[model samples]
Target: MLYKRGKTWWVDFVDASGQRVRRSAGTTDKAAAQELHDQLKAEAWRQSRLKESPARTWDEAALRWLDEKAYKASLKDDMQQLEWLHSFLSGMKLPDQDCRASPCL
Candidate 1:
């Protein structure tokens, strides 16, 4: 995801089910963006596995995880984070099952 106003970082990806998802890691640093990218890829993989393995949808699990968190983030940060996620998830394709490459790799 391109930062809407600059001075921010975002990422997008496409999940296994072909849904676009975005996430914001909230840093302009290249290293940080890379880290978030890896995390988001992992998330997509995990979600995809859940779909194939008799588990809940990513949304369901995400909401549950959010509900379990004891602390709340600032609204501004939350929105930014969401943007980043959407950007990272938007253009991704599910990896071939026989391929050795991991999503983050």
Candidate 2:
């Protein structure tokens, strides 16, 4: 369900775990709010039933890669590569990144 708090629309729903989630939909439009609410509810269901984790960002993956490859002799080279990639991929979700459009690819 959606309700207006001032000008912004907020969503309220119960997840698969029976936890009540209340958050701003971040939009003033009713239709957009409804769509956001549906997406959030669906994501919660998928996470609970399919054991799916939330999408990871490029920075998280880069850090994990560095951690796992810390013992490698070429760790310095890996760090430099990651530093270059960071300017292009920072804050982007892994699945959302388009390799085809990237010059690095």
lDDT tens per residue, model 2, 1-105: 999999999999999999899999999999999999999999999988898887889999999998888999999988999999999999998774457888543
Which has the greatest lDDT?
2
Residue 15's C-alpha lDDT in candidate 1? 68
What overall lDDT goes with each candidate model?
0.62, 0.92
lDDT of 2 at 69: 89
- Residue range 1-105, candidate 1, lDDT tens digits: 434227777777776778887767688786788787777777778768765443344355445555665377665576566567756654454443433554454
TM-score of 1: 0.42
Q: Assess the local accuracy of residue 76 in candidate 1 as a C-alpha lDDT between 0 and 100.
A: 55
Q: How many residue pairs clash in each candidate?
A: 20, 0
